[model samples]
Target: MPPKPKKKCCSDKPACKRCPLQMMKKGTLPPGYTVKKRKLVKVKKSDKKSKVAA
Candidate 1:
């Protein structure tokens, strides 16, 4: 457990501005992320025969 000291080379300067994947690859992706597109309602084989005849 003694082999961890080689992480400071994002062009070696200013500590790479505290890299978090280089600020999400320079896109700054971490502020209430959202991409919503939900609309799933598939269940209509005539309502499955009235829910199997109750």
Candidate 2:
């Protein structure tokens, strides 16, 4: 039998959230740095009928 494959990390940066290294450290950030909060922006949808009429 073959061994199970390891899961891949999804974070863009090294040791970022969702990374195995981050999980191993128990969610603590490196010294002299803080986590930045991301804000969500809502976009308004344009009407297709109005675009076709133009």
Candidate 3:
């Protein structure tokens, strides 16, 4: 079974097993969730916007 996710992050340099940051490195982070600056953040639709020359 996959390891359970942690409710909060300890922000350790070497993230723990249940750390979201570690989970992200292992590509196990759930959809809509991403790690930024070592913190787990919910993805926003606008954040996906890319600058495209029309």
Q: Quote the RMSD, in angstroms, for model 3.
A: 3.4
Instruction: Report the alpha-carbon TM-score of model 1 versus the true structure.
Output: 0.15
Off by over 4 Å in 3: 1-4, 11-15, 47-54
Name the regions of candidate 1 deviating beyond 4 angstroms. Answer: 1-21, 32-54
lDDT string, candidate 2, 1-54, tens digits: 322212444556554454444443464433333232231123345566554654
Question: Model 3, range 1-54, lDDT digits (tens) per residue?
Answer: 778667568877777888987898799888888877766788877756788999
lDDT of each: 0.36, 0.39, 0.78
The TM-scores, one per candidate, come to 0.15, 0.24, 0.57
Off by over 4 Å in 2: 1-6, 27-54
Query: How many pairs of residues collide in model 1?
Result: 0
lDDT score of residue 31 within candidate 2: 33
Assess candidate 2 and give its TM-score to the true structure.
0.24
Ranked by TM-score, the better of candidates 1 and 2 is: 2
What's the residue-level lDDT of 20 in candidate 1? 40
Full-model lDDT, candidate 1:
0.36
